[model samples]
Target: MTIHFSCTQCGKCCHNLRLPLSLDEAADWIRRGGDIELFCEAIPWPVEPPQSDAQAAHKRRLSFAAMCGAVPIRVIVTVVAAFDGACPHLLHDGRCGAYGQRPRVCRIYPAEVNPFIHLTPASKACPPDAWTTDKPVFFANGQTLDSETSELISQSRAVAAQDAQLKERLCAYLDVHHMALANEGFAIHKRAPDVMLAALERLKHDRKQVAHGAAATWRFVSNRLSTVDTLVSIGADTAEVSSLPNALVSYIAFFPSDV
Candidate 1:
């Protein structure tokens, strides 16, 4: 089925959202007095994903290579401005206060960052009227009708890859190193505006050191002990979140899958 979408200016999309941001946008987020959270997840990468496959290519493009104990892995990082209620810039009239200066993600609204993911209107925050026939066809024949959105998505993927290593090191610098398994969930690391800004700033200038000095170690955190045990059996270092009373890390389990 074809998908038609147009912003009815219902402003639902702007409310109670966690917008992903680039590293630069993350810095700007703090300047706006808003908080940013880092979400990190990793997938085992014993062998390089095939460049010919769309999902593999896309995943490799957005992740950085690193070792998990003795296991090699590719880690993906997401920096988000996690705000509740209405967006800080959402005007009373439903206009974006800083529309012109909105983040690239805002410009790519209602679309997914993952190529394999399909857009489901019912799953979106947009209202039913926003998907009426009168709206422009957003997706058809497995393609997005909007070329600019496609371009922005590509750019976002490239930039995420560019910042992948730095973002990982940023976590290391802040002592936020536990990661959830990819496709399962994310290890949420919320940082205060000042702390995150300081870490980013300090890490920015120490890029060379962070990238080349020493390989900072990382551990896996899981809600399922069986999952962690599975990783441990495979020689991957693991951290039990239950044992850490004061660790900044928290796990968001997507499914309680049996290991």
Candidate 2:
């Protein structure tokens, strides 16, 4: 299905929005003379570690499976800080300061909802205020995923850069958790911190034995990354479509058989 909508530049989409950046994206912002601190406002949330050996094995496999697909996934969650009082780069007059080079997350606003059986009212309304939709979009009623909308919302190179950043962050997050597993009274296993750390380090080292170079890098390197599942889970959805305003505006499915 196709969706159609145009932006009137009402600036509503700019409010209460948290545009996250991958490490590369943030770095690029700095390189381009944008404030690095401004891009650092988005907070990273913790991902719980596997509880047991069996679970760890299972999760490891899952992580690999999840990463197999090529579709880029990244989360630019809306945190209070990022949305504190309108983005610093957002002009007082409603224009984005970094329009020509705005972050990927911000560029994808309004068209950012996920694929779900059910959608909240808040989720439905967010897009229409600054844009429109035309597909069987769950969040926005009567909206269809029309070609025009799709064209406007198509992914860009900057978004790909953000995806790479997400990978770096995830690696770092796992490393920190691996360390925490060594605590003496750590609730997970009551294991001694030093002992567990030693064992984990060994395991980490062994996993690097040429055979699993990619997996090894994933474990040893600290990185940032994003995925559609994680992004949709964290972002807020408008409950219903807001009235048309003077503004500009902006999924996926199971695998299909080859023809």
- Per TM-score, the best of the predicted structures is 1
TM-score of 2: 0.38
Tens-place lDDT per residue, model 2, 157-229, is 3344334333333333223111010111011111233333343344445443433322211100011122223
Runs of candidate 1 exceeding 4 Å displacement: 203-210, 245-247, 256-259
* Candidate models: Cα lDDT each: 0.81, 0.34
* Residue-pair clashes per candidate: 0, 44
User: With candidate 2 superimposed using the best TM-score fit, by how many Å does residue 207's alpha carbon deviate from the native?
Assistant: 19
Q: Top model by lDDT, which number?
A: 1
Compose the digit string of candidate 1's lDDT tens values, residues 98-184. 788788888888887677888888888888888999889998887678899989988887778888768767877787767898877
